[model samples]
Target: MTPSPILDLAGLTLEVNHLGRGVRFYSQVLGLELRRHDEAAGVAEFTVNPHQTLTLWQPITRQANDERLAPLRPRGASHLHYAWQIDPAQLEPSKALLDAHGLEWQEINLGTDDRPDPTLYFFDPFGHGLELRGVNRDDARQPHFPPTPVQRPAHALPVMGLREVALAFGDYAAMKERLPRAYGFAYAKEQEDRDFAQFTLGPQAEPDGNGTPRRWLYAWDPQVGLADMLGGDHALVRFYADVDAVAGQVDAAGLLSVRDEQGLAVRDPEGHVFEFVPA
Candidate 1:
């Protein structure tokens, strides 16, 4: 069998309706450095992790041309959910920052059999779900990747690295089986429920000394009233991977669904769109 490609979780690109508001919240409120802002192109880039980045692009209606070689289809404001990792000690200070800015947030406890890591969930100005999770050094549920160097704005708690990304799915078995077969993600942890189930994915390693592996979630039977965030017009999550290689395997597995200028787009059994673009 052809093994899944050595897929490295690069970063994410967000298509936001309000570029100015999104940029301000991510840079000033989230404390990430604004790497670049191109008013003419209507796009902005922010360095979220050392190797990972988050690109914010204005609504397609205003786009004359974009730096990205390919035109992103079905692109507009995104209702995406992504998480960032933070040192445990930085949690209180993070609260202080959010409180000072008057940003509202709620807590989530993703408990495992052993223990639970503290998590704070909030939304960006455009209602994209964002999370700050306390890094648990002892938790096996997390991945250990090399620390990404972030330029911390003065007086703001340091944002460490990308933690986890959650994707909602209707056909759990296909996503569970196909992702590992196509990407080099090894199944790590799982929680099963008749109505809700979760699977974690990452590169298998013996503590590479980097820190933790980037974590991803494939969730099935999403909670009621959250379908918009899962599989709506603006619902999408993109990953940086070797598109050609992935396409090759997808063809081999008879899973190749769509090929476009943007990259190889595949629809999971549940009809969720996942794009793999050139790294």
Candidate 2:
């Protein structure tokens, strides 16, 4: 029998203290298109990829007597880090653009083979670490690259949307063994060093529907501080799955999971939460 399919990474919701600041940074600095923003609802959504959405929501505290007025309060993850894919040709221009804006960025080699995929890591105005990975030339074992472009700042590098997200953990061995088996996601690539080990996850077959490739990176590092800086109780990565079969798949996998109104919630070895929502 064939296994249930985990179609695509449809959404990644991030909590932000200030919705306006988050919007400005992602729209201006990162060059993502602003899809919609509801001030009353306290949420702003952006088109990170073709069909992929990244939402920034601010917490609003309301008083009983003065119900009409609410103040912006701190909520969501503070220092969560995620990477956006950029054309390899734009690597130098991206560096130049960051320098022109007086933003400080650091470079690192994260490729498995000799030629490293050069990545530029920097923080947004709201303190969220954003990475621009030059993976145009890097070959994928299960290749799925689509040419999706967005209106960006003048002379700024165009973002191809989110390519990978890193989930840090204290325990590695157990998560490394179980996640792939449970989710039906294939191991695409991996790279490691003294500090941490990073493994990429993808579907066995090339994904369909607005099908841009995405990577689920499981990172293991014990001595690393600030691993939880960007994410907290509300920081979530939500995937769009076939609702009919997903629950059955989860049950068949025989993994311990909690089923709530939001769908199935599963935790990694070190307690990183992920939810599979109905598509």
Task: Indicate which candidate wins on TM-score.
Answer: 1
TM-score of 2: 0.71
* lDDT, residue 230, candidate 1: 41
Model 1 residue runs over 4 Å out of place are 1-6, 62-77, 112-116, 136-145, 155-157, 170-174, 181-185, 194-201, 205-214, 222-245, 253-279
Query: For residues 1-279, could you state the per-residue lDDT of candidate 1 as single tens digits?
Result: 333343444556576777788788888876777898877677788877655667787765545334342333434325567677777677777887888778887765555546655567777777677777766555554443444436687555577767655555555566667667654445554544343333343335223112233455435445432323342233334555667777877777775356777776665444444566665
Query: Model 2: clashing residue pairs?
Result: 79-229, 79-230, 80-230
Measured against the true structure, the TM-scores of the candidates, in listed sequence, are 0.73, 0.71
Encode model 2's per-residue lDDT on 68-131: one tens digit a residue. 2112122344456777777777877889888876788887665645655667788777666777
Instruction: Count the clashes in each prediction.
Output: 11, 3
